[model samples]
Target: MFTGLSAFPLTPVSGNAGIDEKAYGRLVHRLATTSVDSIGALGSTGSYAYLTREERARVARLAVEHADGVPVIVGIGALRTRHVLEAAEDAQNAGAAGVLLAPVSYQPLTDDDVFGLFEEVSAHLSVPLVIYDNPGTTHFTFTDELYTRLAHLPNVASVKIPGVPADPEAARARIEHLRRLLPATVTIGVSGDATAAKGLNAGCDAWYSVIGGTFPEPALALTRAAQAGQPERAERDSQRLQPLWDLFAQHGGSLRVVAAAAAHLGLTTPRNLPLPLRGLGAKEHAQVAAVIEKLQLHA
Candidate 1:
């Protein structure tokens, strides 16, 4: 199972309306130089849903190619089973370590339908799968029982559960149940720095981090703390991430925070957003820039 921080780099774009492969490689090169355990592109932060099928394939291919030895996992969130299989195939073809699977987006699907989609994915794809359970995007949350059933599927190697809760402790327990119930070969994961430390304490094997995509040094420090059983230091790092959380929640939607962080790091512009969604307005950019300035952390 993969552990520690994983970067979700912004998918770079050229001014002439094409993916800037050079910039994309530079981002991946930067991540490889960091201490992050892996780099996962094409997730929510990478604007996976906005990209066309070919564009998504290019992002996955480029991320893996530039990541060198670091495990590269590309998010595969498609409404159709055929599209899902195609994404998975593309990821394996690009040499990605695995695929991050999310259920059909926007439209609400039954829990059984979600599991069925993943089961179909498991049957055809040779690469290990990491379940992506981010309710903020799908508007559907999977329970421990449901997550376990999915994780136990053959070829399922890991799970990424975003820790979003009024009470971190309760969220931690449900995620832990997936880890405990699944076969030893399966890994349970969590993201959201606010609850990452708790997830690690609760027995999650990894942090499927977005912030790590921009600020790998600090994120890796937090993971190292957890690995060393240093709860005090981990807590300190978690507290430090509060500003990043505020940057997103203050405005709402998944892209703002990462985009803000990337802007702060001088890695990309705050105006850059993938398809289906546009860039942030000037006022919102000001707010994000102000908050990110306090963090004084850059790419």
Candidate 2:
């Protein structure tokens, strides 16, 4: 079962040329060395939507290869169901442990549409399927009923919820309700590092972390505190990351912040982003650097 911090690494791009395989492999090595629960490539942070199917497959292959003994989960979401299925097949062939999927659509998708999409994709996959409920990106929210339905599907292993509510009480209550609704087999994973402490305290089984994917040590530290039921320690660790999270909020979020942070830490080359989306400016880079310095993060 997928549990603990599942790091989602960014896919390094060499301008418009294509994926920077060398840098991407370095990221996988870093995460594997940190011993994160798992590594997810081609996630939203990886900019899966911007890459071609072939590029994504290459990423999955490289991630699986460089991950050493670590399990790899590749994101296979696309607007078209056939494209998603093809990506799933590619991930499975690449020896990935599972595939993460979100119901990405140009038009608003109904519950039936989302359900049918997963049904079709799951029918074709032999590996585990993780339902990525990132409404912020997909613009398609899954109700409790729909999540429950998806949980019962064959090969459906877990679901990644966006995060808990900001309100502490509401967040706990929401997680409790979800626990009641979802089967024991379907692990409830939380995303969005901002509210991660609250989400984990509320009983989330795993953390699908963005920042952890970029720099797993601190995030892994926070996850250990949370898992140990040390709320005060977890909150302190989360607060320590607030400055960096603040930069993410001010800028374009994890996609941009992670790229900037990775560059600042010398993990990859600067300006390694796809077209239509550029790297952070000098001022923004300064902000991320300041936060990293303040946090005392050593790569």
Best-fitting candidate, measured by TM-score? 2
User: In candidate 1, what are the lDDT values of residues 1-299, reduced to their tens digit?
Assistant: 37777778777653237676777788888999885788988988787777788998998888878887888988888889889888888888888888898886667888899989988999988778888888877888887778778877888888787874536577666765564678888777787666787787666788887777777787788888988988778878888878777766776754666665566567764446654455566787777777667877755
Model 2 TM-score (2 dp): 0.98
* lDDT (Cα atoms) of all candidates against the true structure: 0.77, 0.90
List RMSD in Å for every model shown.
2.1, 1.0
Per-residue lDDT over 129-202 for candidate 2, one digit per residue giving the tens place of the 0 to 100 score? 99999987898989999999998898999989987898878999999999898888889899988999888988
Please tell me which predicted candidate would have the highest lDDT against the true structure: 2
Which pairs in model 2 have colliding backbones?
none
- Candidate 2: segments with Cα more than 4 A from true spot: none
